[model samples]
Target chain A: MTTGKGAATRLRIVEAAAAEIRERGANATTLDDVGRRSGTGKGQMFHYFPQGREELLLAVAVHEADRVFEGQQPYLDELTSRAAWEAWRDLIVEQYRDQGLYCPLGVLISDVGRYSPASQAVAAQLVRRWQECVRAGIEATQAAGEADPELDADRTAAAVIGAIQGGVTVLLSTGSTEHLEAGLNLCLDRLLL
Target chain B: MTTGKGAATRLRIVEAAAAEIRERGANATTLDDVGRRSGTGKGQMFHYFPQGREELLLAVAVHEADRVFEGQQPYLDELTSRAAWEAWRDLIVEQYRDQGLYCPLGVLISDVGRYSPASQAVAAQLVRRWQECVRAGIEATQAAGEADPELDADRTAAAVIGAIQGGVTVLLSTGSTEHLEAGLNLCLDRLLL
Candidate 1:
């Protein structure tokens, strides 16, 4: 949340670390590699991330989490109509399918130790944000009478998130979009009148 | 698939490894530790798993997979009635909640390299087997007019699996079964008459 040259430099390092991790994986990427890629030095890295690699990975997790949301884009924001909902679902399916077995945020979290307090906080925040978006969409559709008015938007949206996460997990292992599509379709089917 | 003393010894080794992993973690376990826990020597360990830790981990993956299925018990097999279906759902949520953030098969798969062909085969097999059970239940209920007759059982079952998986993933990160419970309820609501 800082500003100016220092903030820019910090961002550059994060971006570089993300790129390196994406290319060679988080396990293989090192501080030196990030420094070389970002054109930063040990001094600057320490100044920015005093705790070193773990801190940097968490930073990249935030970046990746942002990308996941950003990738959802306009569709995620506008789920008032059936068409928008389907489009959002399709976008999610396509993005994961394209990525196949490698999920950026997943790898970063895995490297950061998924159960660690820091990683858990970031993951929980990301999940909450994602759930809130879907909840908003559900509320919009419900108000318009496009979805079941009696439905609990927050709980239903949480279910929708679970549906996608489950489908994505299956897709990650089996390399198929069938579950992803079917799961999302089922959630929509339940919601849409 | 072998039988006799050799197979017994091999299973003993696998069980010991699984126990060790459940107690500690995959990364912290070693062949020597497994061997010691199993009351077998290096000779027996190598004889059972010539390819070493990867092979052993894959074997444990299979064991863990079996445990996942077995944990579901009579509920997984008899999901024809609404009562039975709810029971099955509760059992899943309870087991995962009890385990909390630690999913044995999940940890094993992660350690064995989730994307590797060997791990994929094991995971794919587990998913297929689980989906088949759900599919069978859907088919059974449909025949009796207890559930939606027109729903595609296979696809719906796959979606159900995705729902559980997604909920489980969220639970692993957030340590709450709310998403898992909500997701399963949605699926049941859609299916049950």
Candidate 2:
């Protein structure tokens, strides 16, 4: 839905801000840092985000929220069999491992989600969409006779999402993917059973 | 280990800072705000925390980290049976629900854990201790033959911890406990299976 030179510049600002926040943290990051990283002047930054830091932060929250699922795309969309689930599991492990101790979405939510309803909605929507994808995958697996057809898809999906979220939180703190692997593996085991 | 008037005043500062951060967030919380809330002066704040805000923040991080497991004490300590597990799960749900929208430990880790080794160590230790409790419970359940004996206790515990973390993360964002409930239920189901 985005177009035009202004849209492209806005996207650049958002991306640069997201990266800085990812590295330096939300509280520590300044608009000057974002402007420098994005190669935009104060005038241009204000042009896109007149409400200043809060508006820019909200945009970064939205951007980071989208990336949470977008990064897992194709694999998240493909769930025809037990093998596909396994592959997706591996992808997730690597994804979090590479991202390491800095989880952009988690940081954004913690920084702005509590104080702002709009930011909270972005996080809620992301979680909802993430759970929906997992539920869809479970249904596909059930239809393929690989999973229990009578299983509660919504609960299962919610559990899976929660496990991943928890895993990432631990990973950020401890620099370990063991929890993520365990959570995903256990969720899949339950699904298979 | 704390005693005397000086220790009490230090505790007061840390507690007030934590409460302010919990309500207003870390970035928005100033030392002046903490001093006012705790009825301490700049002299006392600096005397107690010579390195200033970062030192105070690290202390707050440690304080919050300790509280994470302390709140679930006795119950977390007594996860010896299926019944105890269920009780613990309920307690966890109620605890997070009561806390709501503001996870102090999670916020502290996000704010300081990534940049400082001391803060990261505090977070890592908390997660380790948390998983150990869960693993001990799983081991106990297995000993009673209530759970699959061959299940990987460490991994299972990690997954359960992650699920709880994930659930709380979502709950804070959405103001709902569904994900947390789902994560706990699903993990328990797998454990009992």
Candidate 3:
């Protein structure tokens, strides 16, 4: 049996909206723009999202949040060896580089203030989950005896996350991945040292 | 003799445009919006910026570049002691926290694709200057024996800057300083260790 056509259309709408939001910012992207980009009629969009632009934005936020983890998966989970670390780093660099300067996660999160509380909660949850994944990686690195015994896993994880964010900001500013490379190298080097 | 009225009006227009861009994003802010926000009439705005919106945007880009350095000044020049480092950290955190989620640098950089070559050049200069300051700080720390002699100043400086950018990105996403704190602590801890 095939999945429901309505669900597929809804997913398509969300994906299209995410793309628009990434290309233009939250404020610049409109429901009409999403409709045009997704090749969906206004009625269909309203049928899927009765609450209008706000609801559709929330959907996009969730989708983008999920993509954040999905895009970094497997690599984000495996930090047991130097090769694995380098692979993860390359994946990260490629992900951002391929996307150019547009940051889907940042765009979604930036509009949280204008979005409903539920939307903000979704963003918060996404961040917490992302941090937890980093925490797990740090714990695994420590367990593998690769990091300092006294290092706080949570703190180290937070720092790694921070470094990636900082590097991404620079990448966005300068359209270069040098900062991202530096961040990943520094964090891994410190861990191994 | 005082500066010419034309020059003064031009400065006012740029300052207002920068504020509007920061409060609202690049795409959301318009020439009309800048005029309204800056208390300049349409004719006056045009008189000062003959090249229209792009000219004004370039001006804002330059102003933002200056602010980035001004914001990190004094401390960015001196990171020889624990107190100095802490002061710099405080300045970094306070700068982002005070600005809330509005990233002027991000706003300018995001629109670089649509800007004049001069604007892009200004942004490039800003990053190089920012990186130089970071490099200077690391060198000072090394000279004072605060950091390991074996550590490469350029790489360490790049890492520190990257971590700060990463932290700032997270801060922008989550609207919290926890990640920023983590990045600063990690960098300092590594140096002290």
lDDT of each: 0.85, 0.83, 0.75
Query: What is the number of backbone collisions in each predicted candidate, taken in the order shown?
Result: 1, 1, 3
Candidate 2: tens digits of C-alpha lDDT, residues B13-78: 999999998887787889999999999999999999998987898888778767877888788887
Q: What digit string (tens of lDDT, one per residue) describes model 2 on residues A13-104?
A: 99999989877778778999999999999999999998888789888877876776788878898876888999999988898888656554
Tens digits of per-residue lDDT, candidate 3, B1-193, equal 3269777877888888888777666667788888887788999988777788767777787777677777778898887877898899999889888855555555555564423455556655766777788777777888888777777777777778888777766666556788888888887777643
Q: Which consecutive 10 residues in model 3 chain A have the weakest lDDT in total?
A: A107-116
- Pick the TM-score winner: 1
DockQ (Cα-based) for each candidate:
0.67, 0.75, 0.55
- Which residue pairs overlap in candidate 3's backbone? A165-B166, A166-B165, A166-B166
Q: Quick one: ranking by TM-score, best first? A: 1, 2, 3
Question: Which residue runs of candidate 1 sit more than 4 Å off their true CA positions?
Answer: B1-3
User: How do the residues B51-73 of candidate 1 rate in per-residue lDDT, one tens digit apiece?
Assistant: 89989988887887788888888
Worst 10 residues of 3 chain B by lDDT: B107-116
Question: What's the C-alpha lDDT at position A151 in model 2?
Answer: 78
TM-score of chain B of each: 0.93, 0.89, 0.82
